[model samples]
Target: MRDPVATAMQVCPVEIATAVLGGSWKLTIVKHLLEEPLRRGQLKRRIPLAPDRTLTRQLRELEDDGIVHREVFDHVPPMVEYSLTELGHSLAPVVTVVDSWGATYRWTIDATK
Candidate 1:
């Protein structure tokens, strides 16, 4: 868990949710993992905007929060994959709502322009 999630006294449900989910690429990562397990390189390609370091950090945080499962295969190159935990899968509805809201917001902005 991140410092804010672990160390701070957050009282609001929304605040606690944000603490766990509000990092730069966190939601996007979760959204992608909702579909299927992916390799590190696959996630990097999917979220090309996030730097490797940022993806790595958010993934670590999510793992700490018990939202994602990271599995390693004993192979010549040590393959790794990431998949959403039961908790992470629970975010599907939230992700769908947010995605819809963002598209509506963009449409609204374009209409005004």
Candidate 2:
């Protein structure tokens, strides 16, 4: 028979986790927001290569998943800020692991060589 650990690992595939968080800018957005709340412009500045429409769509998906909270301020410019919901907070540790893995694995690519 197969090992229990192997069976469990296969039961919950990494692809499933990646599917939830693997989009181009999703991890970048999550990493940027891990510390504090941020406005749309601030996020745009943080990840300039990300298209505004794509970012909006991902944020909407996160919000629908109960992992992000959107707050709107009634003001002259109509301020809007996003921060983690309780659910999102639960994801922080998972995100951190992924971040650390990227940090370690990314160095393998020799940019100049």
Q: Best candidate per TM-score, number?
A: 1
Candidate achieving the largest lDDT: 1
Candidate 2, residues 1-113, lDDT tens digits: the string is 12333444566767445545656787777888898899989999999999999999878766765667999999998999999888777778888998898877777665545
Tens digits of per-residue lDDT, candidate 1, 44-64, equal: 999999999999999999999
Stretches off by above 4 angstroms in model 2 are 1-19
Question: In model 1, how large is the Cα lDDT of residue 70?
Answer: 99
Clashing pairs in 1: none
Pairs with backbone N, CA or C atoms under 3 Å apart (clashes), candidate 2: none
Q: Positional deviation of 53 in candidate 1, in angstroms?
A: 0.6
Model 1: which ten-residue window has the lowest total lDDT? 1-10
lDDT of 1 at 102: 90
lDDT of each: 0.91, 0.77
Candidate 2 accuracy as TM-score = 0.78
**Backbone clashes (count) for model 2:** 0
